[model samples]
Target: MSKKSRPGSRSRALVAATAVVVTLLTGAVGAGAAPATTAQRARPTVILVHGALTDASVWRHEVEALQRKGYAVLAPAMPLRGLASDSAYLAAFLKTVSGPIVLAGHSYAGAVITRAAEGDPRVRALVYVTAFQPDTGETAGELNARFPGSRLGPDTTVVLEHPGGSELYLRQQDFRDVYAGDLSPSTAALMAATQRPVETAALGEPLQGRPAWRDTPSWALVATKDNSLPVATQRFMTARAHSRTTEVASSHAAPVSHPAEVTGLLLDAIRGTAY
Candidate 1:
């Protein structure tokens, strides 16, 4: 994970969806049909999934925080091009986790986790941090169209704000008012310089089956000041999926703004859903 002043979303790409038997970090969430005793035991494996255009590095702080709290975590790298590619990758990853598992994702990756959760019984819970939690048979594109005035994504090819800005790409100074209103000028500039460009096709693809969230105990972190994915859209998705909710006054980049809070929620989900 890059240090402070790093640009863009640092996300570990979700490679595949295989059931992975993992060890618990704090609570007794391991091996079986949901656990009978629900006291804090050991931290289970924490799998972090990244959104489009970004890589696995976005989860740096949360990953470290989870580990410090005692979780054997894994954040898979994903194929940013489309949902099917990411889903297949996640499916393969979960199959190997032997015990209770907490699968989490941000932004577009939320849909990826949703698609992979079905049929795979190993996944104990989910965390959607400012992400898109898709419903049964609905495509990401369909959800984008739901807002009427506000689509889930931007149409133009997300371009780089500067020539030498690494991979960070977004509208100039937009985060100031929308996503990262609380951030300083320097911080916002850093995010802009490192922003990754999400593949255009990733947004339009829809879910083909039931979302994994329906059966899984789910938690969501909504960025109230987001400019990228509308806050209303996130609310709609959460309500439609019937997930446990938490709100933060950040931007679309909640992990970046509030890594501590994100990690804490993830821990709670893993411990509570420990089986």
Candidate 2:
């Protein structure tokens, strides 16, 4: 009886060992394949394109906020040259991104994304942050004039002739009033001092090809107190593009003055498009 029991115990031990080996192999395969499956389902990258008169630093807060939620974020410096040239540059940059994208633009960059995202399938959605949404064959300057509330006239800006072309800058004295009325005076002064100027011709250059907003789903953040591009103009453009609109009591520099609200709007666009 003891010998028979011993044989049965050995058989059970062998079976248990085989089962453990199979389980380990299965887990190894699962561990290796899980990341690829998860990667395929990962959230889309968020590219925040800063508008003219400001560099990518304008998206600093949004970048930080988005990163906290595990989203990959990039804020590229725009050439701010001409519409065609800048759009070409942005389109080229989009090529470097590897997965689905939630493309966002602030102020003048909206016009750039409008054209740059054309024909690119990776850009899942467009988020306009108090941005310019020009139509095909339309120019930023033209859109600025569609409404009467804008204060971004010659009075609030300065023009300088560079070797290549003239660049436009927000005047430090009036930057707070025109672009960042919702911000503190000190912060506005710092922003004015560091603001990057856009080429004068960029504002007047017509967006060459079809506007991406015409094809892609879009979201717009309207800064109700914005003085640069008037809220009315923002509403008109977003409405024409059929964009989901969110209004906040912010200035033209919504990204800087209201980063959390801007982040929320961007997240909305991401969730809406990142199926």
Candidate 3:
């Protein structure tokens, strides 16, 4: 008779075969797992900064939409003081973020981010939403003065009057017309009631350093119907900054009224900018 195999030997051979098969399967699965792409690995945290006459609450819709898309978002309450102070505050805040940042600004906050991002490598991109993109020596007030479509001048009132500086707010009656014309009446009324006043000194404060836009990739949204910052001014600034541009038929409150459009531009910046 052919030499019969021992029972223990046969069992050991079967176990060895099963172990080899399992090892090969595990290796195949591990090899097939793809590494994260540059786009996935480089998604920077987005920091949204609100401008004069508005607080962080104004970005509610945008915050919701960005969060839904799995983007890390922060809408920080900006102290609308002098530009230097505001920019310093933002620069300090940026230190708290763990990774790369996409800094976005609305209205006057644009100037703040411009200065804040200067020499800061962490800020990968800048987004301007109907915002004031001031050059090194330029001021928001000067930019607004250049284009005259804004009705904000008449709506403003002095909150803390002083020879050196003053705080200003949009009159409740004119807030809807000037700032939130496209919003529902009730919504406009609420925004008007809760509007934050900004320092006149802030508007006049000259930028301290070279604009971040000069070095950083930028995206801009021109609200065609914006009465606060004229669409022409928006176009001029975006062109000057060499930024990727998008236009929407909305008021200065685009974040609130046309949140989808605003969010789309921000996503574009996030995707286009490399980490």
Tell me, by TM-score, which candidate is best. 2
| Per-residue accuracy of model 2 over 14-93 as CA lDDT, tens digit each | 99999999999999999999989987777898999999888899999999999998999998988888888888898899
Ranking by lDDT: 2, 3, 1
Per-candidate RMSD vs. true structure? Answer: 19.9, 4.0, 5.1
Q: For model 1, where is the 10-residue window of minimal lDDT? A: 12-21
Evaluate candidate 2 by giving its C-alpha RMSD to the native, one decimal: 4.0
Report the lDDT of model 2 for residue 71.
Answer: 92
Looking at model 2, report the run of 10 residues with the lowest lDDT sum. Answer: 1-10
What clash pairs does model 3 have? Answer: none
Local distance difference test scores for all models: 0.74, 0.91, 0.90
lDDT of 1 at 55: 68
Order of candidates by TM-score, top first? 2, 3, 1
The positional error of residue 107 in candidate 2, measured at the CA in angstroms, is: 0.2
The local lDDT score (0 to 100) that residue 240 gets in candidate 1 is 79
For residue 224, what is the lDDT in candidate 2? 94
Assess the local accuracy of residue 73 in candidate 3 as a C-alpha lDDT between 0 and 100: 94
The parts of candidate 1 lying over 4 Å away from their true place are 1-42, 148-169, 172-179
In the range 45-148, model 1's lDDT, one tens digit per residue, is 77999886456877989988878776788888786667887788888888877666788999889999999888776788899998988876677656655665
